[model samples]
Target: MEPGVPDDSENLSDSDIRLETVIQQARLAAGIDGQNYRRRFGSTLETDFGSALLRCEEEGLLEAIPGGAGWRPTSRGFRLNNRIGLLLLEHRSSGPDMDRSNAHGMAES
Candidate 1:
């Protein structure tokens, strides 16, 4: 209902949305390589980058590029990305700058 946030009227579960959102943010911030995710967020993450990508693809939120190792967010995914990014920034700004613990928290279920 808020401006700039994705509509949650779709069938996606809250957990699915959250993981896809985190994946999109990670893709934008640290590149799509799974290694980048593990390095930045640690290897014990509940949802790995590859799994998140697969889930997003399954949910029709991301489309794989033809003959390439990359993917492009679908329109839905794009809106979700923008919405999620804004929410994250807003939350971060509302409090102390996010620390590693908070970053790790995002990866948790």
Candidate 2:
């Protein structure tokens, strides 16, 4: 119902959720803007920033600030993002591409 928010009828993929998680991490590290996100990740934005922010909020990983103009990471969000980052790092170091074994149920053999 909110402007820029994605429709709930559409299903978000795993990559979408992953990107949203990382967005929260980026927001915590830099700020909630495309430029900072692209700078931190070294890639152009692949997901809609507003939708990702909404997903993070729905997942309890982020909270809108008092003025509703920005967000801050929740304690749980910090832990979740750190864990995901470490997992991604480990996955990348293990191989050129993530497979079923390394990604922990992400792929099929």
Residues 1-109 of candidate 1 have per-residue lDDT tens digits of 8999998757875445544545564445332443333555554222433344445566666655443324456777665665434443454345432232122233332
Decoy 2 TM-score against native: 0.36
Summarize candidate 2's per-residue lDDT along 1-109 as a digit string, tens digits. 8899876776776455545655555537433444454455543232323434445556666655442324556777676765434443443344343121212111112
Write down the RMSD of all candidates, one decimal each.
13.4, 16.1
The lDDT for every candidate, in the order shown, is: 0.46, 0.46
Off by over 4 Å in 2: 1-48, 82-109
Q: Least accurate stretch of 10 residues (summed lDDT) in model 1?
A: 96-105
> Which predicted model would earn the best TM-score?
2
Candidate 1 accuracy as TM-score: 0.33
Candidate 1 segments exceeding 4 Å error: 1-48, 82-109
